[model samples]
Target: MKPELQLSLQFADARHRGALARHRVARFVRAALETSGRIAVRIVDEDEGRTLNREYRGKDYATNVLTFDYEHEPEVVADLVLCAPVVEREAAEQGVTLEAHYAHLLVHGTLHAQGWDHEDDGEAEAMEARETELLAALGFADPYARG
Candidate 1:
């Protein structure tokens, strides 16, 4: 189990509510993948999120989360940057708990790092199903369900 999962977290947000458990987020991601490499998650504000997302994805606006899959030869060192404010607002708008939303995003990003693409309907369904199952095991609600 240890050999299959690796994640490193960096909290850079101004607010540390201590309301959400970082480890829950990590475990949520780890439990979904067959990874043997590290995925680093950094909590950032809109400034950093906007810059990084714009630079890499060509989207001028800051997204709720961005996943940068490592393009190396020998190591999988993906980076997942999550905008804290966006997450909070999204949770409220989506009518989900902050922790559940965080879990959904982390797991979503982790799957992206592991080559799970959801550009089409079938792919999206498969990926969402996997996410639902993984989150359920972790005691989180289905992220796509209407409130």
Candidate 2:
């Protein structure tokens, strides 16, 4: 059975959020989940991103994507935080379009919300493989592929 997705998107940084449309974001997220519940995808500036990372993860800098998994089982529920500046920088560094990078991060965060992790080598490999397949299905290249 296909999962039902309930996505709520918030833009704390409006300047960088419009590059990715709401429908595209939802499509990428839905492709990564096995079953659906609800997800909140918030695009934030460096300040809020750094604050959340420091508060929740002990990191002092703004990261590209942060996934907070609230539930996983009969239904998947979570929040995905994407740092706009970080994402833009990374996209430039990786020589990919902003939309492609957003799609990859959305897929990555959704996987995390569904209880997928890359804590170890084996786990990372499996998770990355799944991500690649899903992205390919969505007409995106492998996000981890070297240039």
Candidate 3:
């Protein structure tokens, strides 16, 4: 059996959009790593997303999600900050289901927390392929699958 992991989901919005998706996320992450840890997912707006991405990654744009891997001491404490607007826009433009897209991004972010990066072409290919397989196993469509 996979180890126990705790998750906390926060939303900057007044509604419960992320709350609806939390269980899927928890299932995805836990099954992927098969480890014991604590993770927090925060759904934020553009401003906060931009600020954080800039501060931590030195990127000035508001990306979909930023994963902060605080520690890897078995009990992991990481933060996944997702921008709602960006996610929605990407979902529509890419012609993917919101739930499937969300699953892909969450898996992508979790991989980052586990020391995966796509900084170069070789690394990008490897990570992207891994993400594709993981998403498929999670019952999600391939995010990189073109229509």
Candidate 4:
């Protein structure tokens, strides 16, 4: 049986209000998840993103995406935070569409929530390969691919 999914999305940055649709994000999350549970995706400004990163991750700078996985096993529960400004900047720098970048991040975060990691070379390679496959299945290009 397919796992059940409960997804909630919040856009704290109004500047990118219509940049991504809820359904598209849901699709990406669903595709990347191995099991189902509640997942919250929030789009925030750099300030909030940086604050969260500093407090939770000890990083002073805002990042493109942050995943907070609360549970993984019988069910998966997590929160994914995306810094709108950082994401936009990176998307432009990478020459990919905003939606595509968001999709990639959603998939990446979902995988993290599912207990996937990249702290080592071998793990990173495996995770990237899975991400590439999932993105391609979703009709997006390999996110790690460079021009």
Candidate 1 residue lDDT tens string, 1-147: 543556677888846448446667567777766646677888998899899988998988779989898743354568888999899999899989888888899888888887887999999999999999888988988888874
Q: Per-residue lDDT of 56-103 in model 3, one digit per residue for the tens?
A: 989999999899998776666788888988888898899987777778
Candidate 4 regions off by >4 Å?
Answer: none
Backbone clashes in model 4, listed as residue pairs:
none
Clash pairs, model 3 backbone: none
lDDT to native, each model: 0.80, 0.92, 0.81, 0.93
Per residue, candidate 4 scores C-alpha lDDT tens digits across 27-63 of: 9999998887899999999999999999999999999
* Model 2, span 40-81: residue lDDT tens: 999999999999999999999999999999889779889999
How high is the lDDT of residue 66 in model 4? 98
Order of candidates by TM-score, top first? 2, 4, 3, 1
Residue 128 shift from truth in candidate 3, angstroms: 1.3
- The TM-scores of all predictions, comma-separated, are 0.89, 0.97, 0.89, 0.96
